[model samples]
Target: MPSPVSDIPAATPDLAAAHYAGKLAFETDCSDVRAAFAAGKVDFVLLDVRSPALFQQAHLPGAINLPHGKMTAHRMAEWAKDTLFVVYCAGPHCNGADKAAFRLAKLGLQAKLMIGGMTGWADEGFAFESQAAAAE
Candidate 1:
């Protein structure tokens, strides 16, 4: 089987170090993600590569919805070149994040996959936000 990170675009030094150090790797433990959020180390964009309806139901707060299919076009204009991106899909088995990460890398954005995705986030009891809800 192909490594999950194989499809991802160029890895930034932080991500590369994380890969070697086993930090910032795609993890099923959402607590780490929450901690990153709490520490303000996650200044990158959080992207939901799921469908519109799924996104409307629930998503990470501050996550920008950029369904995978739209990523190759102008919709990606919402993000800046220097923006670091954390992409997620439905779950670990899902490859949407990998594909999105590849696209982001092709576009020259620094990107990484959240690995465990939303299911992991929900399992960890981390907070979620709806499209209509305001960000904290």
Candidate 2:
């Protein structure tokens, strides 16, 4: 019998390539975000779809705290209609990022989830910013 990892036949190379490429249309990762920041090549808006209190405690630098629940078309209109949003929540354990993405889509805005969220950022040894620091 095939080992568990190989029990199911893998997709053909072409299908696998398409599947992975398709996923990139909706998802990004902490490492890529960091690299964009480091290179000053950020072309998207980064949103923290977490509560105000949690966001005040800690959040990704350059991320704007706009909890998913408050994502209205009016609020989002603050940005240009063509702005691309990248959203993240607390971690993989949370679905706030997904909710935010859904809301953005419903409002006819472009969005992508930053996979792994804050947990992934921490895992990558990234520095975080707090609301207090942002004031200064």
Candidate 3:
């Protein structure tokens, strides 16, 4: 008897490859973000699509706080049309990142979701920055 995991036939290797490759175009993980920052190769903008208050509390070092609700074409125009944006929210439990990505797409910009969000960063034991420190 096929186990529950295998009950549904898996896609062929080629199809699986395509599926994952497609996913990579839309999402990135915390480790890659950190690596980019460490190597000074951060070519994309990292956006924290959470409330300003939440953002001030703690956020990724290089991330900018831009709540999904405040995403407007006028505001996004500050960046080049082809600029790539990487967005994240509180965690897997939040959809703010998805909303921000959708808004960016609507404005004809490219965006990818940073999987795991702040929760993922914390899970990776990455250091965080707060607005308080920036002010000091």
Candidate 4:
């Protein structure tokens, strides 16, 4: 196998960190996320970290609700081991996704924050499903 350092191709430690940060950021975005979902990829689960009320207002399709505050190792007992969770909240103004990811990490679960979140998805002209709409 190639040397791990040479494989990444970073000129400096700072640059390496920055590059990895950007690459990590892409783990969750509207277009890429949507494509992954439509293609039925099994590696990740979309997690809505917002409260049920907010999730009811609108949320990404197929996302499961798990409020950051209520998240704990025990609360995640039902989740399969090693399954990646893509966490998101209302919008950029909301830090719920980050908090949720942190909490999940504390419990040894893998989680990625969906950048731009609900607002970002809606801003891209994609539609969201609200409880009201679902009921109608």
Candidate 5:
């Protein structure tokens, strides 16, 4: 019979370490993102791939709306080509984030998926600002 998965933790330390390293490389948690925003020293741009109406309702402090369905050359042309993008959607239940990441990749832009979407931020009690507020 095969042994239980938990019984082999010590034997797979390298695997665990590599997995964690890879995760950190591809995903970032909200706290680190918030800190970067507050410090005004970020290595990537934040993107929210939701409908304009939803975006207008509320979004991350610095996230710019780039609706997944409307992703196109004309829409993307204004943004810097080399900037790394961190994308999020409504929440984990929403696949808009993954779709947006795929589109960004197709456009040859570097990107990483934020571990949790906006819901994650709200769950952590982070404030969301409306587009109207941002306009001011």
Candidate 6:
């Protein structure tokens, strides 16, 4: 017969904290996120946290340009609480998305990182919107 103590399962909360500290809580792979966008299930904000020049060059369709350095709670308030905000930067080496996600989280908003950033988004061959299209 199993001992009474053996029946108890180990709680992962403590271990998980150590493993997840200094890392993003929600990390969605590029393909999954792309599929969600294609299926129209992703109605959340796709925030581009890169520089203005990079943003103007090209960005995911429907993405809002909010450079990481300039992000403020007031500016982010435009989005609804229920909205699922997805943040991205230039590439894997970039930390802008992480910063943006943290800021959003501090404001009591839910934010997730697009794991590979815009470079991965571009590699997926997803269409991007530009200022020209917005004006048209």
Per-model lDDT: 0.78, 0.96, 0.96, 0.84, 0.87, 0.80
Number of clashes recorded per candidate: 0, 0, 0, 0, 0, 0
Clashing pairs in 1: none
Candidate 5 Cα misplacement greater than 4 A, ranges = 1-11
lDDT of candidate 3 over 1-136, digit per residue (tens)? 9999999999999999999999999999999999999999999999999999999999999999999888998999899998999999999999999999999999899999999999999999999999999899
- Which segments of model 3 are wrong by more than 4 Å? none
TM-score of each candidate structure, all chains considered together: 0.71, 0.95, 0.96, 0.80, 0.86, 0.73
Candidate 2 segments exceeding 4 Å error: none
Cα lDDT tens digits for candidate 2, 39-94 = 99999999999999999999999899999999998899899999999999999999
Q: Candidate 6 residues 1-136, lDDT tens each?
A: 7689878765599877766764555776578777887798876788899988888878877678898777787887787777778899987989999999888888888888989888887787777777767778
Runs of candidate 6 with Cα error greater than 4 angstroms are 1-25, 133-136
The candidate with the higher lDDT, 2 or 6, is 2
What would you estimate as the lDDT of candidate 6? 0.80
**Model 2 whole-model lDDT (C-alpha atoms):** 0.96
The TM-score obtained by model 6 is 0.73
Candidate with the larger lDDT of 2 and 5: 2
The TM-score between candidate 4 and the true structure equals 0.80
TM-score of 2: 0.95
Candidate 5 lDDT, 6-90, residue by residue in tens: 5555547888899889887677878888999889898898999998899999999888888877878788777799988898999
In angstroms, how far off is 71's CA in candidate 4? 0.9
User: What digit string (tens of lDDT, one per residue) describes model 4 on residues 1-136?
Assistant: 6698788665789888999898785457887788887898747888899889988998888878889999877878888978788989888999998899899888888888888899889888887888888899
Q: Report the CA-based lDDT of candidate 5 relative to the real structure.
A: 0.87
